[model samples]
Target: MKYISYYHNPRVSNLLRIVSESPGLTFTEIMRRSGLANGVLSHYLGNMEKRAMIRSKKGRKMTWYFLPHDPIEEDSIIISLRKETSKNILTFLLTKKLATFVEVTRAAKKSPPVVSITLSQLQDLGLIKVTNGFVKKYEVANPDTIMRLSEKIDSTMFEKIKDRFEDTFSYF
Candidate 1:
């Protein structure tokens, strides 16, 4: 466990504070909320990361920034789900509990191929698994951890992402 000293610069301190408050926000979210320019924010984050003051979970589309030392377990499943599409899929599965591929495809409003790839990715990350039973359903490996980890992220951001996915379901 590394103990990092506080940042002297206010902007850097503010960035750290923001990440601490919203542990699972992406780089875009941070920029939007912090009102910091790309180069400046990037520089501060890089410094923080090198000092072990902050850490990030890199996703396919974007990296989810977080404090290096958080109370949450920082499981790989949670890290992987930091990606927008993956988080959207997990949110869908968590709400429905158990769903078939067709059902997920319909609810997520994502193309069949995209949904399929996301499902396989989730399974590979150990966040979810496909049942071997007759129905061949998908279910989260640990709903409890998902729920707990969900509490650490910004609800507004999560809701926005969720709403976009839900809108797809509404289309059908």
Candidate 2:
């Protein structure tokens, strides 16, 4: 006899579908897309997490959610790049190829500390490389792969997040 899990409720299913479709969504973002109330979403998220149907990473401001062993594991870079500051820094580096720390801070319009931390995180993830010498410079490790992965994600959901993300970050 097989043991059936109780995580297949409609609400839980919807949450899983959303996370699977767009991995690395913050709790707030997931709530927005799932239309689940804060408490309700929290309950389902916790339950799913306990069941090992989901996993989350604590971001600078929010907890980002994802499915375990996501189908597009190669696209995990897109997941980490979901943060506004990280997105801005990487996008800037993708366009500029190589840039100094001050250039990244200026182009990305982020503060020195935020840029520094985000750059370090990207370096640790192997998504970007930083060189320190007379000047510190940063560059994306795999522009083509990042681009391809970015294109492969669901555009509709990504657009929704991107729109809200830009709106949320514009105030900062």
Candidate 3:
């Protein structure tokens, strides 16, 4: 599975950082620190938990939010690609590394017009290089950059997750 860039999402990123730095914070505490409404915070927390970025323990009256020992990595290529292309196109690209226009349309499950526009936007961002032909070839550009960014993102994510888990669950 490829790692995506959900970390760039402000709500998710902030919650992870805060929980990692200070575990076992109640919903109120997280809201106070994060400056997010209870509903928004809860939504982000739920998404993170689904992603295995964090876990929760319910006590008598209070709920403690903690990070999981292992957090899943997002797809670096897809994340970066989305910055250049539409998310749908990026998802298709992930499944089909080098695809023709027709292939992208099929994989993206979008109309040809939409796929073409997205491909053009990505090409403009230099995220993908395209060759014109009966069957155009589209290749991912700056793979090294993507890899480097992935490493950086994963390192930061793991560091935060580790810190949160230790702070909340460690028996030292």
Candidate 4:
């Protein structure tokens, strides 16, 4: 509860802001976003995690950070949002409520196979539910939670990722 209050230190506040806005971020990712030196960031992150101000998950190759209260399920959701097709499909379903494979394939604007796999992955993540009938249907499992996670991970970060992919082409 105390972590809910504003920090007197701007650096800590900025660090928290970055993690809160973009959960499931690796250590290097957090450092890059914060523009803090390696030693200082390492110290701050370690201290915060120790103080129960933030949480970290050890991935195979890296450690991802999140707000202290974020559930483990949110890790995959935030990661998936980094991919365009997944986010697009999720957003579409969130709005559409329910749609068949054909409708989703069209809305996702991806190849049928690709859409199929993405839908499967979404279902595996429990973000979307599938209905079996004359036609298979897909819909968001928990609209409120999905929407909140979508909102939690900053869209601006995705734009930054896009810029990197575009590689200076966006400047003009």
Candidate 5:
């Protein structure tokens, strides 16, 4: 007899529940929440995406997965900032208000390609904007949102842990 469907797998159901409750989560965040190994999670995520059960937004630093209709916005920016270099670049821009590419590279203390990819990712998320004039300068599009994210990043750990146990008990 055929095995029960993949959808019946506890891990897959858990993953779906996680995405439904907290859409726009990064792969690592999903893995952490689900307690899945990298290779296994990658395979399951790929299958889910292929079947269109979920959607993912790819970035230089992260890939955010969510239900197809969930809006990403601020959550996407949070994932980007989770990357060390991207966070440094954004932090620098937030302070300077606006700065040219060279200034950002210097401030981030990362090589051109690294800075370039980070900036591109930020631009893609609409978290930062680039203006074309004598030179291209980058600025944080929404300082308040980013400032809020920066403030809340460390504070969310307890909530995440609590949510894990909550989900565990939810099945009872």
Candidate 6:
């Protein structure tokens, strides 16, 4: 299943926060920590499960819920952040290295107001560097690292496809 975006969901955020505090927790415990009703927690859990952000093990009596992977990992953090904000901006920053507000607006094909808000939010998260001037340079922080990591992780499926295609057509 495709990963459902959970970046802005309060329950998912609370769930992640709770999981970060303590890795392995049952749904009941998570519910307790989140102070959300079972129905609400269940919906969040289902979404997280679809995203592979969290996993569950069905015991005879109860089910346990926890992050299948590390929450502090850079990719996980990026995914969570993108889920919470404009993924287009993330792509633009990662691809363009640095972009001013105007540049982002054009690249994202979004309105000036929307682009400005996204840029401001990313700046608040310390993900981008924005400057004020006639010709402002909004350099992406750690461009090399973020770009390299994104490429490494995102290329896996494409690499596999390329390999398969080569294997099938190389003789021709």
lDDT accuracy of residue 150 in candidate 3? 35
lDDT of 5 by residue, 1-172 (tens): 3339877878778999998776667899999999999999999999989988899888777788878765555667666667689888877777677899999999899999999998998898889999999999999999878766665554463344346446656888
Best candidate according to lDDT: 4
Model 1 misplaced stretches (Cα beyond 4 Å): 1-6, 59-61, 71-75, 156-172
Q: Is candidate 3 or candidate 5 better by lDDT?
A: 5
lDDT of every predicted structure (CA atoms): 0.77, 0.77, 0.64, 0.81, 0.80, 0.63
Candidate 1 contains a number of clashing pairs equal to: 0
lDDT of 4 by residue, 1-172 (tens): 3455436567888999898877888888888989998999999898888888898878577788889888876788877775688988887776667899999999889999999999989999888999999988999888777667666777664454445436544556
lDDT of 6 by residue, 105-135 (tens): 8877888987788777667766678776888
Worst 10 residues of 3 by lDDT: 70-79
Query: In model 3, what is the error at residue 56, expressed in angstroms?
Result: 30
Q: 50-165 in candidate 1: lDDT tens per residue?
A: 88888887757778777777744564655655666777778878767789988998877889999889888888877898997877899988877776677666456456545755
Worst 10 residues of 4 by lDDT: 157-166
Clashes of each: 0, 0, 5, 0, 0, 0
lDDT of 3 by residue, 26-140 (tens): 7887899999988888888888889888887665676667678623232223334323235455544443457788777776677888778777867776767887787788766
Clashing residue pairs found in predicted model 2: none
| lDDT by residue for model 2 (1-172), tens | 2236566477878898898877778898899999989999999899889988998877567787878886545535766667678777876777667899889999779789988888888898889987778987889898777655555554653454456547656886
Model 1 misses residue 4 by how many Å?
Answer: 15
Q: Estimate the TM-score of every prediction.
A: 0.76, 0.72, 0.40, 0.66, 0.53, 0.45
| Candidate 2, residue 63: lDDT | 83
